[model samples]
Target: MPAGTGGSENYTVGQVRELNRQGVPAQVVTVGLDADDGRSEFNDIPFRSLATLSEVGGLDGTIVFVNEPHTVPTKQLSYLILHNPPPIRDEQKAFAVRGTRNRALIVTSRYAAALWARYLDVDVSTINVVYPFAEPCFAEQPRPDTSAGTTRVLFAGRLSPEKGVYTLLETLHIDIIEQDVALTFTATTAGADKPQGKIIERLLGAHPGISVVTSRKTPATMAALMADHDVVVMPSNSQYWHETFGIVSVEAQHSGCRVIASDDGGLPETDCGGVVLVEPDNAEALAWGIRAAVASGPLSRAARQDAAARFTVKQSVNALLNVFAQPAPIPPATIIRQLEEQVLAPSAKVATTSRPDNVLIETAV
Candidate 1:
């Protein structure tokens, strides 16, 4: 389960849906209190209340899957952790305590897993790397004309500080205003505070050419917005709130828009040969990247098609199922010895009664 919307929600929803399509029993549980009318289909899949997940019984031997380990109550069960963001030091401590107790940890990228292993002091054996996949919506569609006159640049996400909106504004100032290029900045505000909205308004006010579209766009609307644009720019910084896996980048690529994204977090994973990665937080670098993307001309229909094929929901589902099907670690010999001496003898009778008779027992004596 995840905290809220973004790449985590999108990945979970799409992966679970695809797993169901493949006849694999999969479900998504989210702690989102705000009622979203459309998420009902997935909400129907055995949603245990986030508040009550710890107290709710009967989860033994069941693989509890979690996207963000810090958000969920991991003390309850062994989890397949999906590490995405750059974890805070305290978050790492929490994960370290929980991960050593859980069954296994799975990360979306090797880079993330390596970081966790290094910082959390966990054995590398416990962590697994599984790359995320884009939904079918990102499959290659027809490309629009890129004839250099007026290019539309779309940025579909929250207008928050971590997204580098200020940096994006600076990049726009350099590229559009200073360079005298006709470019449209299409942005949608998802979940930002009043102050952030005010800052965005001020930025937009400074540049009349930059159009700020603020309304909740559905999947179709988002796709349409992508299709309407000639290029997609993601100038996210390496801050805690950076993009993980860059789902919007994939969508833009599928819509046949050249993608220029920041080289941070899981963005490199989304490069997919179609995206151009630029230095994070460098406005000059971003401006140059955007200019190069525009000069590089429209992506060939074949390149976009290849990118779409590379990142499909089916592939993501298959990877997750493969991880799930893999045999969990047998209790370590030292752990077995310790449990046998301390836990098994005293609790065996109670455990035998509560657990199945067929449950295997390793005696200490």
Candidate 2:
């Protein structure tokens, strides 16, 4: 069940769509979002809600793929997908408490699993790492050699501080100007149209050659963009948002662009020999990486081959099904007790002490 928009939700939808296309009888069950129950369509996959799951004969034999393990229900078989390490202190507790309810924990990379194991204090052996699959369109496309003179650099994702958009801009301003380069910044909204958004607009406006594309691009569009660029920079900051898996990095590599990513979270894991890893939150390091990437020229055949070998939809689907096939280890009674004691306990004081007028506290028996 997908719970929010981003890479995780996109992965969920992609997996379900692929599974259904492969005649696996898979469908999406959206959680924490308003969707009608039974036989709805989203992203071309059949969707059903938690309430109408049984009506579709899902309850007889089913596994809930929970994207975020917050207030997890332990009655049914479940697999928790831990994409990123808990982003905040409260989420750490929630992940730890609710993670135990799952039969298996899935992660996109080994680094992600390790982070989860360390953060949740769970056995390392219990977590499963299923690398995300890039769509077929993301494969290498024949493009012109962009290695000489000016390098075309592309930055894709949210235009927020957490995404290191500002840091990238700073790098371009300070160091990258010496090197002839073309930079493009694309996102849904410029930092939700905040002051930083104004800063981005000004930066782009002042830099006459720099380009900005404003739209939410699909995978095909992103792949097209990657195919044209010489380098793709994903310089996310760990303190702000630890990137779970650099799916876009993989896409770039597959599309024949050299990737320069931060060595925070799972970007290193996703770098299958074609990526240059740099320290996060450092403009100097990022600039160094960009220069290094440009010097190295376009991705070599060997590097491209290795990068494409890292993940595939077939491999990911097999891994997911394997996890679903396994039975849960913990009893339902134990999970309920853990939820009441560990999950709800921390929130109890807050619930009683002070709650906003808009907030309503509800308990399930």
Candidate 3:
């Protein structure tokens, strides 16, 4: 599987893993990514490589494409999962949307479906929701002890402005805390290798009383990290980024930790009985939110139990299978072609769909 260090990577790998467990076949086909490109994370999931997404247009059977929409429409059944919000400019995203037509468009949350619908000028129902699940490893994590009068707060998101690392930086000083926020703050180097990540890490280094560590590479590792903490913060920036669905927010709750996230976007929906919503992009609000989480003490056993029933791989995969079972709507072009083939003589022309570099296909279950 491609070595992505964010929620998108976790969701893709987690879905593939669960799909196999449920006897539904799924394989990760990467464009511009190799089998051993960077890290061996999510190595259990099967992976295939293609030079460009266009090569998969002729791929038969049900193909589920994630993130980037393919420029070429699939010859058979397909689905596009819009993990990120649409681009600001209409022209920038319109081409990509129109280029890959007739596939059922999927979004992570109702908020995301509406956001994309408003941008693309389509009905909200046209975009479907398939919420990402917290992999079993997260819930399997042992809850941390928080009765020691100190709440261990962890910022598990990528150290970038959109993820709200900068806002966090301005929120945690003594002036803001003033003994009210009695917590040991820590930040992860999730995207520290990237240009923006490097700058954020440097800024964190200059700050005081903040512990820094390398990003957890796997769900098990990330779960372990969350289990060691009492609370997880997701102060997502609303100005530059509207979080489609904060998967990490649910994951943290599954780990038996309270989630302090922005009130906007789909973040509010990520609550599994332990999320505390605060104003987005406000340092003071985040600081107060942290203080509130600290004052509330440890998450109760009752509150922690809702994650399994509400969000799980079984539910997510079954919902997807149901979506796939629905008959695909035929477009006008497809009907026209069918009519022409009935009256025409023996077909001589063969449609070509291939790239210079061949795409590797693999089967999974």
User: What is the per-residue lDDT of model 1 for residues 166-231, given as tens digits with 9 covering 90 to 100?
Assistant: 778788767443565566677765544457766776666567657776544344456666777878
What are the per-residue Cα lDDT tens digits for candidate 2 across 257-336?
88888889888877766789999988899988988986788887777777777677777888888777776555333646
Ten-residue region with minimum lDDT total, candidate 1? 346-355
TM-score of each: 0.77, 0.77, 0.86
> Which clashing pairs does model 3 show?
none
User: All models: lDDT?
Assistant: 0.64, 0.68, 0.80
Winner of 1 and 2 under lDDT:
2
Over 231-327, each residue of candidate 3 has an lDDT whose tens digit, in order, gives 8999999997899999999889988899899999999999898889999999899888987887787777777777646778778888888788877
Q: Between prediction 1 and prediction 3, which has the larger TM-score? A: 3
lDDT for residue 302 in candidate 1, whole number 0-100: 79
Instruction: Flag regions of model 2 displaced more than 4 Å.
Output: 1-5, 31-43, 50-60, 72-75, 91-96, 99-103, 144-148, 176-209, 331-365
- Winner on lDDT (2 vs 3): 3
- Top of the candidates by lDDT: 3
